[model samples]
Target: MRSGRLSFSFTMLMIGIAFLYVPMLVLIGYSFNASPLVSVWGGFSVKWYGSLLHNRQLLDAALLSLEIALLSSTGAVILGLLAATALVRFRQFRGRLLLTGMINAPLVMPEIITGITQLLLFVSMAQMFGWPHRGLTTIVISHVVFCGAYAAVTIQSRLITVDRSLEEAARDLGSTPLRAFWDVTLPMIMPALASSWLLSFTLSLDDLVISSFVSGPSASTLPMVIYSKVKLGVTPEINALATLIIVAVGACVVFAGYTMRRAERQRDQEMQAAYRQPAG
Candidate 1:
């Protein structure tokens, strides 16, 4: 009976993997198709990939998306670090509950509601001050609002496992709280910070609904452009664009894994060497 259960579990796992990956595989294959029809699947060709260079609108949108992602990710990281620090280090502060709720509201709230609320807020601000418009600035700010929530979650999770005594020790040695954090806590949470930054960047890059609501026509993001194209019907060029993105993202993931593994091995070797050394 156990063996049968194991086999069933294995079959289910395989099915799950296929369900997730088969569509991606099909999309990648179609990206190279000579024909424009998605279902027809003509012989392999790279024409669509070549055509991407001349598609200036798509390129502009992609560039704008990158800029927004970069700015929002940095802003998210900074805001997230502060929020995470506050939540983890100062647990008994006034209005902590309210602050925590505001920070995490994006995680639980529906995207449509968040987007509409942000749109309304921007409209109100514009009317009140006439200082800003719905464009890259608004998009970046909206992206940071949600992305910082995710970043805070990631950084806070890492901070939870951190040894507080280390920071205390730094403080005991005449370091100020801010200096202790910089000297002790920051280094330990660098990995989490990096992960949060990447997550923020990815979220901002892939966002559609929020960008669509907040973005001006002059600052349309890549996802908005791709979404419109999909509505018309998926073409080989879009498939090709997706394939390139997949490849780039996959490469970055692989590189990050390799870098992390190498760092881990180096740390392990240092620990072993320290263990072998004579004590004072």
Candidate 2:
């Protein structure tokens, strides 16, 4: 009975995997199709990808998206790190709960609401200050607002796992609090920072609703371009683009996993070597 149950569970897991991945597999396969209709498969051809190179508008939009992603991700990481540090280190402050709630409120709020609110604020600011009428800057600001919340949550979680004793020990050894943080806490949480940055980058790149609301005529992101094209008609070019993005993200994830594994292996080897060394 136990063996039968195990076999059943394995089969269910396989089915779940197939259900989740089959659509992506089909999309990737169709990227090579010669037919314009993505649903219908034609003989393999690289024309779509080749055309993508020549499409100046799409290329420009893609570049804009990359820029927004980079800038917003950087901003998010900086703000999030500061917020996370405050939340973790200044736990006794009054209004801590309120601050935490405000920091996390974006995560649960509807995207439409967030977009509308940002748009209103941008318009008001523009009218009042006559600054940043509309463009990449506005979009980056909107993205940073949302993405920072996610980064803060990730970094705060990592902080919770760290031992405070390490920092205390460093302080006792004549290191300033800031210097101790740099030497001890920073190294331990570096992985979380890297992860948070990547996560924010991906979120900013993939954003559509908030970006669309805040963006002006000059700044069109990749998602906005893709969305506009979808409204007109679905094209094989979109499939090709989607496939490329999926492959890029997948490669990054794999590379990160490999690097982490290598670090672990090196650490294990060092520990084993130390154990094997003569008693001191």
Candidate 3:
């Protein structure tokens, strides 16, 4: 009976894995098609990737998306760190409940509604101040608002798991509060920071609905451009572009996982060594 259940679980896991990866495998395979028509494959070819270099619109859009992703992710990480620190470090504070609600609201809110509300807010700010012309600035702000929430959630969970005594011990050893945080607590949560930053970058890069609502006519993100092109019809070039993105994102995820695992192992070794010490 145990063997039968194990076999069933393994079969279900394999089926789930195939369900998720089969579409990506098909897309990657089609990316190498020699023919322009995505439906008909002449042969394996790298011409579409080469052709992407000359596509000015796609290139520009990609560049813009990267810039936005970088800026927004940085902003989100900074804000998220602050928010998570506030929530975790302070046991009781005025407006703490309100702050928590704001942070988690984006997690449950529909993207379309979030986009629409952000658009309205931006329009009002524009009409009132005339400072932020709806374009890159607005898109970055919108991305940061939502991305920061996810970043905070990631960091908060990590922060909660952290041993506060480590920081307190550092403080007890002639280290100032700021120094303790900088030297001890920060290193422990570095993995969370890295993960949150990567998550924010991916979210900002992939954002379409919020971006479309906030971005002006001039600023077009990669996803927006790809969406428009896909509406026309999927081509080999699009497939190649998508394949490149999947490969790039996959590489980043792998790198992040490796780095985090290494850090964790090192941290564990340090803890073991410290515990073995004779309390010097």
- Lowest lDDT 10-residue stretch of candidate 1: 259-268
Please report, in order, the local distance difference test score of every candidate based on alpha carbons: 0.89, 0.88, 0.94
Highest lDDT: give the candidate number.
3
Off by over 4 Å in 2: 1-12, 264-280
TM-score of candidate 2 on Cα atoms, chains taken together: 0.90
Quote the positional error of residue 271 for candidate 3 in Å.
1.1
Candidate 1, residue 128: how far the Cα is off, in Å: 0.5
Order of candidates by TM-score, top first?
Answer: 3, 1, 2
TM-score of 3: 0.97
CA lDDT for candidate 2: 0.88
Deviating ranges (above 4 Å) for candidate 3: none
Q: Looking at model 3, report the run of 10 residues with the lowest lDDT sum.
A: 35-44
Better of 2 and 3 by TM-score: 3
- Per-residue lDDT for 147-239 in model 2, tens only? 999999999998888879979989999999999999989877777788788989999999999888888877889999999998887688988
lDDT of 1 at 177: 91
